[model samples]
Target chain A: AQTVTQSQPEMSVQEAETVTLSCTYDTSESNYYLFWYKQPPSRQMILVIRQEAYKQQNATENRFSVNFQKAAKSFSLKISDSQLGDTAMYFCALRTRRSGSARQLTFGSGTQLTVLP
Target chain B: SAVISQKPSRDICQRGTSLTIQCQVDSQVTMMFWYRQQPGQSLTLIATANQGSEATYESGFVIDKFPISRPNLTFSTLTVSNMSPEDSSIYLCSVALGGTSTDTQYFGPGTRLTVL
Candidate 1:
């Protein structure tokens, strides 16, 4: 069984500042995927970024990036020049592909991020 | 990304009642999943809805308690049978963004359930 963990329960960042949310997971499988999803006040789950385990390079979106260290089993999300809209609950997730598998996504407890102006 | 929609965005139900939430996707998707989000918590996969076949439930969940149906490629439903206070949570329907899999899971707006 794979377990994803988010250490920080709550985080705050000043407007235009940067903040990094930490995430770590335990999985025996080699080929898989990691992701960060954001849930805003609207309660809609939105995809922030995704990283393939096989890729050595990190994944970067417009305002979000991840520091993925597979050996350390760590995948962290970095928000650059944070905006008020970036205030949301961020969740780290793992996707596994088993033999004769129906790939499923598993999630970790979220970190509530508050962007203060 | 597929556009997924879930019906009965929210509802208050009696403890012994059953409520079925519907999910529809704008485009055909081979795989769909149902999840539960307890208040102030992370999401948990409830089951995998496979088109034209039975749904595969995860541990700690079952078909009798939360029956699911996937009649087609773009639609699925989850019914919370004999609801309890513990059943109160936001139910979400998700689908893979791609046909070949390994794509990010796209979520619906979510259906909030409250049992009295």
Candidate 2:
């Protein structure tokens, strides 16, 4: 079984600043995928960024990037130029492929982020 | 990315009742999944709806409690049977278009179910 952990339950960032959310996972699989999802008050889950375990380079999507340390089993999300719209609950998820089973997503508890103006 | 929509965006149901939530995708997808997010918690996958076959449930979930129907590649429904106050959570539907290991999933606006 794979488990994702987000140690921070709540985080706050000033507008136009940068913030980093930490995430760690435990998995025996050599190949897997890591993802960060954002859920606003609307309850809409949106994919923020994703990183492939095999890739040595981190994944970056505009202002959102990840510091992926495969050896350390750490995948952290960084949001730059944070805006009020970035205020949401962020969750870290892990997806692995099993030999003869369906691929499933395992998620962390979540970190509530508040972008203060 | 695919557009997904869920019916009855929210509903307040009495205990012992059932609520069926519909999920529709704008484009055909290879896989559809159902998830539950308990209040103040993260998302937990309930089942994977396979077209033309029975849905595969996760551990702690069963067909009797969450009956799922996947009639085609773009439509599916999940029914919460014999609801209880513990079932008061947000139900979400997600779709994976490529059906590959690296394919990203797109989610629908969740259905908020309140059981009293």
Q: Give each model's whole-structure lDDT.
A: 0.91, 0.93
lDDT of 1 by residue, B46-103 (tens): 9988798899888999999999989888889899999999999999999887536466
lDDT string for model 1 (A8-101, tens) is 9999999999999999999989988899999997888999999999999999998899999999999999999999999999999998754234
**lDDT for residue A54 in candidate 2, whole number 0-100:** 90
lDDT of 2 at B102: 69
Candidate 2 regions exceeding 4 Å error are A98-102
- TM-scores of chain B, in order: 0.96, 0.97
For model 2, residues A29-60, the per-residue Cα lDDT tens digits are 99888999999999999999988889999999
- Per-residue lDDT, model 1, residue B73, is 89
Write out the backbone clash pairs for model 2: none
Candidate 1 residue runs with Cα over 4 Å from true position: A98-102, B99-101
